[model samples]
Target: MSSTLLFFIVLAAMALAYYIGRQRAIGVVGGVSQINRLHSLPSYYGYYAALLVGLPAMLLLLLWVGLQGQILTALTLAELPPEVTADLSEGQLSLLTSDIRNLASGNLMGRDPSPAVEAAAARFQQLQQIATLSLWALTGAVVLAGMAWAWQHTKPSFRARNRVESILMLVMILFSLIAILTTLGIVLSVLFESIRFFQMVPWTEFLFGTRWSPQIALRAEQVGASGAFGAIPLFTGTLLISFIAMLLAVPVGLLSAVYLAEYAPRKVRAWAKPVLEILAGIPTVVYGFFAALTVAPFFRDLGQSVGLDVASESALAAGLVMGIMIVPFVSSLSEDVINAVPQSLRDGSYALGATQSETIRRIIFPAALPGIVGGVLLAVSRAIGETMIVVMAAGLAANLTANPLASVTTVTVQIVTLLTGDQEFDSAKTLAAFALGLTLFVVTLVLNVIALHIVRKYREQYD
Candidate 1:
């Protein structure tokens, strides 16, 4: 049976077990009227039984699915002629295995298989069928045994609720461990690849050198193909665009938030907040198109009219559109933070002869400053990580210039470019993407840490 079908069958079995367990509990308590004699509720008993039946069977299914491919592959390879496998490298063997599997499934294999390969493919198919049947039988047996055991154990004094709660707690802990382990895995993978990249291109050159070209010539004798791994230009461009975005976003978003939270009428605030937040729901690609097609042209024309040179794909266009895109993020969070400031603070300020604007500027703003800063940090991170807008509007020339009207590229754009084509992972060009990813990850992590520290420190002061 297919995994999905087997999953549904297991669920049905669990449902049946739940019904049986609930009725058994009621019977043990001498009917519904005497149900109060039970240690736990009938629902708890049902849940306990369902979990006992489902969890063990699902775990067995998962373990079988995870190991079946390796086992089948090993068995199939054993059926292949020794002469065919003796001289094959790991990569070649993997490709041959793929071809065998494809042939077994009657799919296109890109090339005709030898007789030995065809024989192995047939064996593979037979083994796969056996594995599937065995998995189904074993899973069903496990489900039946677990349900029977749980039903026999269901009694008036059974601690079903405690057992269920303990299982739930373990599941929660397992989920948390999965998240932490996944993060650690990512960090280690990126770190290793980055180390390899640095070995090819010196760390000092990659970190501090000004140029950013990453193309390596296929032949050593190729002309004019010096691959520069300098990342300074990309860093400069990213910061410049992000700074421009923040300049446009911070004032406009914060002012709008303040107006909606404190000054605007109820009806206006109600309608305007949602309308402003709708911008966050719009996809970044749509914003990219707006930046490229609409904003870039308008800026180019205006710069031309003013007798100033503007590139067709300038950082200013991307930054402006990105700032607009991030406005909702800033506004929504800041509004909530501002509104959370105590009304008592405002009254105290008023009693001190402070006007409404003065109260907001001095008292409310300080109290809410931590959250506002956190929101701005989040917006800044959003702007930094944005790829579509940078790729579509800002030209991919990694020019190390401070002029926003000039073309530039970001770290994300370069990473995408480096990894887009079919390239060997061993090459510096491909490894550079991992290096850039690690740097970006570290930068964002630092920003988050700083934001959290500031929020907590100031929150404690206020509270």
Candidate 2:
């Protein structure tokens, strides 16, 4: 249903409750015609009654509808024939339940159904209709009964507003608790998987091993194969790519942001800002292919022409393209933050005869550094977690070398290769992806914490 329609329904119900409550309160007062004799000034009692009736019913309806399909399917299975049940596996049974529900809802078209199945479908349809009707009636009855009870309890000394406020506070706390619990759940799940991976492969071996051969043959007659879970190479690759990307991105991005924020004409900025943001809107996969097809080969030929040995899939190609892709990331955020710095700081520097660049370096940049650093940290996290560009342009070989000309593999690339085209889930190979994930999470977490701390410290200086 549309929100407007739902809201109107609730408003109408509340209005009815308010009118009924006021009339009932006046009746309870008997011969007292004084307006000041009211228990809760009528409106508070109405709000309390509406909240008591509407909130619980709405909650129940939402919960029931959310779980209705699953509960009905479970109930239907209990009523199904034993022979039909035995013939279906768990997955197939779930599919059958879905089909039956579809048939019950009159959504399935053009089927010549057997009498037995049709009868069952008809019975299910009846049950669903009855359940929906009963819920609506129950909601209305409960709302009316709550209104009547609250009206009867109305006394000159009643504290209905305080009661309603307490309930609202409880609801707010519940919402906050749910948000915190969800974040905790995600952290715990990652921790559990990391623990499982560590149990399968020793923490020391996984962390320090240099070779990453994650193959495990399933057959008994398979030839000798080694699987190593060394993460050092992946970490090295991540750093190399991030370093190269930062080299290309930071100077160009920061310069552009400074130009836009400080020196651009108003008319020019109006057009240029959107164009810069549009760069960010382009998909990363497009950049990946661009790096693979155009940049890598161009760099390879360029290196060969200069008598340098550069791999076709070198870190420079991936990093350069990835850097171009991330330029907008730095520029957009930095531009906003630089603009947000108080103009008084710039005016003060100008009063002392400081040039534009000097003012920016001394006052504006320092003031905006927190926001800029946050943007850079976010971009770094993106570069670290990037998978597609590295997968295509960077080679799969886990070279521990940091030379930009040499090919290297990254942590994200290894995780992708490990999980894709899977054989057995229980093997060390699959579990190793979790270990890599945990490592990635921890590294990103530390980077964020340090960035935020530095930003906070710098902010205090300016303030």
lDDT string, candidate 2, 30-83, tens digits: 633764676566677667777776676667566756776666666666776777
Q: Top model by TM-score, which number?
A: 1
Residue range 40-137, candidate 1, lDDT tens digits:
99988999999989999989988998998999999899878899999999999999999888998899777778999999999999999999999999
Alpha-carbon shift of residue 91 in model 1 (angstroms):
3.9
Clashes of 2: 1
lDDT of each: 0.93, 0.81
Worst 10 residues of 1 by lDDT: 454-463
User: Could you tell me how far off, in angstroms, the CA of residue 243 lies in candidate 1 after the best superposition?
Assistant: 0.8
